[model samples]
Target: MLMQIEALLEHIEFLLIAGIVLVLAILALEHKDLVYAVFFFGIMASFVAGFFLLLEAPFVAGMQIAVYTGGISVLIIFGVLLLPIFHDTTRERFETIRKKRLGIVLSIFVIILSGSLVFLFTWPTEIPAVNVDLAQSLEGLAQWLWGNHGIYVQFIAIIILTSLIGSLAILKLEKAEHLNPESGVYGLATWDDDTSEKAKAGNKSEDTVPVIMAQDAEEEGT
Candidate 1:
């Protein structure tokens, strides 16, 4: 009787966690606001970590929390915050809106498909227990990452470095474009006040040069 009660409680806990994770996933994908989407994603990652813990994989759960919830989510949030300053435009906004709608549709489709699969499939009644030693697991993971799987780490580092270089290049180009008013993107030049004033002065100077040359010619003829 006690074992049945414990099993029932575990099932309930799993149900709650699964439900919350699904909800969070939908919110993360379908939300209009990028920051809110990232926030939901982080929460979903945390819930996934909890689900891993419930499966008796504590080290995997901790790694999920540390890698996804703590690192990648924070990085995405920062990117969402900072990217708009450089890329804020009507076209970009429209694209974002379109993508949000697409995301909503995809999320709905995925949920329906997943539910259908779950309904159609027969899940095993008995799940095998996992006995994990944290220290041994960590050591093995570290060895895998740094030894035979070292190429994967190198690839990831290269990708990150390439992205960083690309970002720096974009910033440099944007700065150069901002300095040159003619190169401003989509008629939106930063430092508009100063650039406009300089442009007006240049126009005035060019106009006066023609007038001054004509006056000099007329005086010489007279």
Candidate 2:
């Protein structure tokens, strides 16, 4: 009876995880707004991590949730916020004809490749015995990460940290440019009283008509 209950629990967990993954995938693919798309992407990454956890890969799952869903998603949101023009309006940029054609071709290729791979792979009819020792798998993953792959782990950490710093720096530069026109960070000239006067002078030159004041006097003499 206990074994049957445990099996049922495992089956339910699997179904729930699969459902979450499907929902996340749908949201990620269908969302139009970049902000909403990033949000759904984060959710999708979290669901993927959950699936990995259910498969007894705790370390990889934790890293997925932490690095991808948390760190990267936050970075993306911050970058979006840093853009001065982001708040002005919400409109989809129309894709060029060439871009549309390329996208369609790439999508068709992916569909065909995936279909062929699925059709080629044979499913085993025999059900393999499930490993009930979840703790053992988690321990093994921890050992592998800290022992054999510690250097690799450190390298990845450093990469993520550097990327975060670079993104922040770019955001700072954009914000500075937005706030100060005189800074000339993006080839933007300062708009002051002198600049306004220069513009008026230029306009006056175009609008002004030169007059020959003596031309009428000479015609009268003739």
Per-candidate alpha-carbon RMSD to the true structure = 14.0, 13.8
Off by over 4 Å in 1: 1-6, 29-34, 83-125, 181-222
Best by TM-score, which number? 2
Question: What's model 2's lDDT at 189?
Answer: 32
TM-score of predicted model 1?
0.60
Estimated TM-score for each candidate: 0.60, 0.61
What is the C-alpha local distance difference test score of candidate 2?
0.70
Candidate 1: residue 93 lDDT (0-100): 27
List per-prediction Cα lDDT, in the order shown: 0.76, 0.70
